[model samples]
Target chain A: MREVAAAERRRRTARLLVHGALAIASAATLFPLVWMLAAAFTPNDLILARPFRLWPEQATLANFAAASEAYPIWRWLWNSLLAAAAVTAGKLALSLPAAYAFARGRHRWRDAAFGFVIVTMAFPTVMVIVPTYLAVVRLGLVDTLPALIVPSIPYIGFYVFFFRQAMKALPPEMFEAASLDGAGFLRQFVDIALPNVAHVVPALAAFAFLGAWNIFLWGQLTLASVENKTLAVGVALFSDIEGAQSSWGPLMAVNSLAILPVLVVFLVARRSIERAFANR
Target chain B: MRGAHGGSLQTAGLVAPAFFAVAVFLYLPIAASGLLAVLDYHPATRAFSYAGLANIEAVWRDPAFRVAAWNTLVYCLVLVPAQVVVPLLLALGLREIAGSRLAPVYYACLFAPTLVSFSVAGAVWLPLLNPINGVLNEMLIAIGLPPSRWHTDARAALWVVCVVTFWKTFGLNLVLWYAALMTIPREQIEAARIDGAGFFRRVRDIDIPLASPTAFFILVTTVFTTLDDIVGIIDVLTGGGPFERTTNLPYLLWQKGLVFFQFGQASVVALVTIAIVALLTFVQFRFVERRVTYA
Candidate 1:
């Protein structure tokens, strides 16, 4: 009886320790983001105040107001949305047919071509930026949305490879049966393969949207005009060019605003995002 | 057979638009980069001449390129182990927790930063790490230590970049590690436990070996991705400042090509970066393939 009681106590102690450690780690992981949000609302004077408070004594919208006035936040957001949407749509439109072919079709050059696509995935985007910039400049696409959209299309190759992997896991018998019914390859892809990979669409779209939204190096280099600038470039406008001094309140406020869309998409589609990452 | 052959052709034909698009958009540019690397090309002159090995020789001799490569190597060496090991440990530690409710919450917090842009993260961390009026400095003062200039100080700047990049992506490593951990059969662990193995022993003997494949996957991918994907961090954070200590090859490539208009040098650097990544990836696949056993 005494031994049983001792064993129960040990089990309880282990459980307590596990819970404590998890709580601590989770808090540490979340502290930066939570602190960012907290500091954003804290009065500008108290933001750097010692013994950072979890909750601010006084809150103000002044930071946000300043950010809005200092930059074209709304316009940047709209441009980002439009560009991201176009990129995502173009990725799907271009990648779907390619992925279907890679998955179902047999050809002599298919493996070679697919290998080429996968190899490009490993090449750093920065390496290609110079040539791509030259191409855009030659085409007179610099400073236009087309410059952004055109470069983005290449990235869809990764998505094509991803979708093809997913499609390959589907039963081949279904495709064969569909083809037996006289449905052309395009029709079969549209009627059959499209519906089956519906789950992946949201996941791919989320990935593409985040990539487009967070795109900075390209946006900063290519888009010279403020009107063409995405939110990332727009947010970057807060830093003083000569001194590198940034307005603390407006900078944090705009930074928070910049991340809000992606955060929303992530929260709404958390499950899909989880699946997308988990699959690989 | 004829019908099947025709169908295959039709499928290939259907896929042609995407194939052509990817080739024209992605592969062609990359190929062009290779050709440009060997040529004396200038955007201003709109002229190109064969430079033979000149660009390659210049890049090989460049001090900045050497520093960037060294920094990238150091970053990868420090980051890859921490990213793979810490997350695996955390995930393993979480396995003993009783309630399932806390798992999702733990994962949510861990995964949150992965979704945020590195640029925004950099912007957010900048104020937090500011020297005088920054919170980090204030905390140091509270602890009775001197204030440290994080981004401005050359010695500390690369580490600051490292920390931010790690924070942004560690959650992803955590998630991947967690999923891989879940796949380790309970029986294998329990059997080890039954055989008088302690927790550490079980982890060392059973878990680590089982998780090696996943670790290898994460390691190679992270190394290549970090070498390539850290453009956002560099662009936003220090702008490769404080004497360009934080500039990786990717950032250097951008700076030389676009900012300095040194196309020949940039192309050489780009080609070198690609070659290094390709070599590393090939080596990793060869080494890992022999050890990775998928059931």
Candidate 2:
């Protein structure tokens, strides 16, 4: 009885130790971000005040107001949304069909062609940026949002890879049965394959949406105009443009705005995020 | 003979659009980079002349490129191992409390930083690390410790970048590690415990071996991301400043190409970095992955 009790006591202490460590680790990981969100609401003068805060002592919308007045902060947000949404839509439209074909289609070069696309997943972004930027410049699309969106859509390598995995997992009999039912290739893909993998779509879409939303370098390179900048690029340059202590609240507010959309999607789709990485 | 369905024409039709997009944006640019590496551009004529290996030689001899290359080496050496191991350690801890009431909360808090953009990651850390007005030093002083410059100091800037990058990225690997850990059959672990395998012994013999494939995956990705993913962090936080002490190859490529308009030099840097990454990734898959499965 004493041994059992001692063992139980040891387990309890170990559990307590683990819990304490994780609590501190989690809090330290979140401190800067939570402080950013908090400072976004704190008045400008007190944002830099000592003792650090995870909550606004006196909350106000003045920071948002100031950020919007100085830069096209709202417009940048809209632009970010427009570009990210289009990019996500384009990724799904392009990748799903290709993934469907790769999974169901059998041709001589099918695997080879799929391999060709898969290879792009390994190409570092740096290798392609200089030339892609030059191409966009040649086409007179620099300083435009389309320059950002159109170039990024081709990064469907991972999307195609993931969706192909999802499709391959579906029973082959389903596709065969659909074909026997006189469902054509397009109809089979749409009517049979699409609905089954529909559960995976939202998760992949959320992941893609977050990726597009957080694009920084491409946006910085392409979008030159103040208003044309997305929230990420614009807000990254916020301090450079507004060189004053007063810019702190507004900068934090805009930075908070930049991360909010991705954060919400992430929290809601947390399980899916895990599954997405797990399956990959 | 059960064959996967669809004719060549059908496959062609479905795959063409995506292939076309990738061909234009991805393939064409890759080809262009190769061409630009060997070609010289004159703004006066807006034309390219074949310069052979001149661009490569120029960028090869550059003192700044040399510094950037060395810094990148340092980053990979330090970050690649840390990136792989730290998350696995965290996952082990989380596993201890896997089903507790606060597991999800702790998981979410660690991951929240990952959801932020790399540039915003720098912005997020700036307020807390800002030299004069930052709260970190305030807390340090409060604890009776001498305050230190964070990113502004050349000696510490690269380490700061590594820490931030690791903090932001380790979460995904954590998710991966957690998933891999959850897959190990509970019976095997319990059976080992019955045989008197202690915690460290169980982790070493059972957990690490079981999770090796995921470890390999995390290793390759950490190598790739360590080289490229921190460009935004470098750009925003330090701008590779303090005399370019923190500039990696990718950041240097960006600065040279767009910022300095030296396209040829930038393409060379891009090619060099790409070669290093490709070789490293290939070596892992060839040798490391082979042992991972066989051993």
Candidate 3:
């Protein structure tokens, strides 16, 4: 009985250690973000004068106003939203059909076609930048939101792979039953496969939005005008224009605006997104 | 038989858009880049001239390209293994508290930084690493140590970039590792325990084998992103340098093309970077594929 109690004690100690270590690691990992939040709320002078504090002595909305006045932050935020939404819809529209075809449609080169799309995943996105930029320039799409959105959607290798996997897991009999009912490939896809795999769509949508919202270098390279810039690209430029002095608060406020929407989206889709990665 | 027969046109219709878009945007660029590497294109003048091997040869012999190549290696070496191992270990630890109340808290906190863009991440860290009244230095001074220059110093710049990039990127791997860990049959670990296997032994004998595919996946993705994602971070944090100490091949590609508009030099850098990527990926398949097969 004493020995069993000792074993329980040892296990409890191990669990405590694990929890403690994780807490510290998580805090360290979150330090920069936490600092950004704190600095965002504090007044500009205090931000420059004092060291990092978890909570400001007094919080203010002045920085948000300043960030907006200094740059077209609201415009940038809208541009970010428009770009992210378009890219997400484009990814879903393009990939869903392709993935469904790969999963269910009949073609001799079906696998090869899927391979053709999926192999692009290995092409490090930067490798294609110079040429993609030239294509955009030649097509007169630069300095436009479409410059960011249209080229961005072709990165659907993972989306196709993911949705394809989700569709493959469906009951094949459903498709056959639809086929027997004279529902063609389109009907079977729309009525059967899409409905069945609806659960995974939001998770992919969340990822797509987050991915597009965070587009940086491409946004910088293409959206050269101030108002045309997305929030991700704007924040970097904001810091450059503001420098690190009395503007730390506004700098961080803009950073917060860039991050908070994604945080809310992550929270909303947390369970489904967790399930998505956990399963595959 | 149902799987074998469908209207060819319908199937083609379903697949054609993504097929064409990817081909045009993704594959066409490689060809474009190949041509651009050999022929000079002046953006201002809109003139193209055949330069033959001059661009490639110049890039091959350039000291800056050599430096960037070396730095890229440094990033891959430091980050690839660290990304895989740190996250795996954390996932292993988190398994102890998997569904506990604090589990989601830890997940959120660790993942919070990832939701932010790399530029925002760099912005967030900029103030913290600020040489003047920065928190890091303030804490150092509190402990009676001098506040060191963070990313501004060429010697410290690369490590600073690596840390920021690691912090920004590791959350995805951690999540992957956690997911992989969850799928391991609990009974196997329990069986090992009944057989007197310790934790490390079980991780080696069961968990590693079970999680090897995810580990392998993480390894390959980490390798790719280590060379790719740091560009934004480097751009925001150090702008690739006090003396280009932190610039990698991707940054070099950006500088050569967009910044300087040397289309030929930029295309050469792009091609060379892609070649390196292809080589690394091939090496991973040759050596790592054997280990990833246990799944």
- Whole-structure CA lDDT of model 1: 0.77
Reference-based lDDT, residue B210, model 1: 81
Candidate 1, A158-247: lDDT as tens digits: 787888888888887777787788776667778778888877688878878888887887887788887788887776666544144546
lDDT of 3 by residue, B215-263 (tens): 8788888887898878888988888888989999988988888888888
TM-score of model number 2: 0.96
TM-score of chain B of each: 0.91, 0.94, 0.96
lDDT tens readout by residue for model 1, B1-295: 3321225676678578777776887778778888988888766678889999999898889899899889878877887777777787778767776256887788778778887777787777877787877777888888999999998899999999988888888887787788777778899988987677988999888877787777776877687657866767766778887898998888888888878887888888888888878887888788876777654
Best by DockQ: 3
* Rank list by DockQ: 3, 2, 1
User: Looking at every candidate separately, what fraction of the true A–B Cα contacts under 8 Å does it contain?
Assistant: 0.52, 0.65, 0.74
Score residue B208 of candidate 1 by CA lDDT: 71
Which lDDT value does model 2 have at B160?
89
TM-score comparison, 1 vs 3, better candidate: 3
Comparing 1 with 3 on lDDT, the higher-scoring candidate is 3
lDDT (Cα, tens digit) per residue for candidate 2, span B178-225: 888887888999899779899999999999888888788788778877
**What clash pairs does model 2 have?**
none
Which segments of model 3 are wrong by more than 4 Å? B1-5
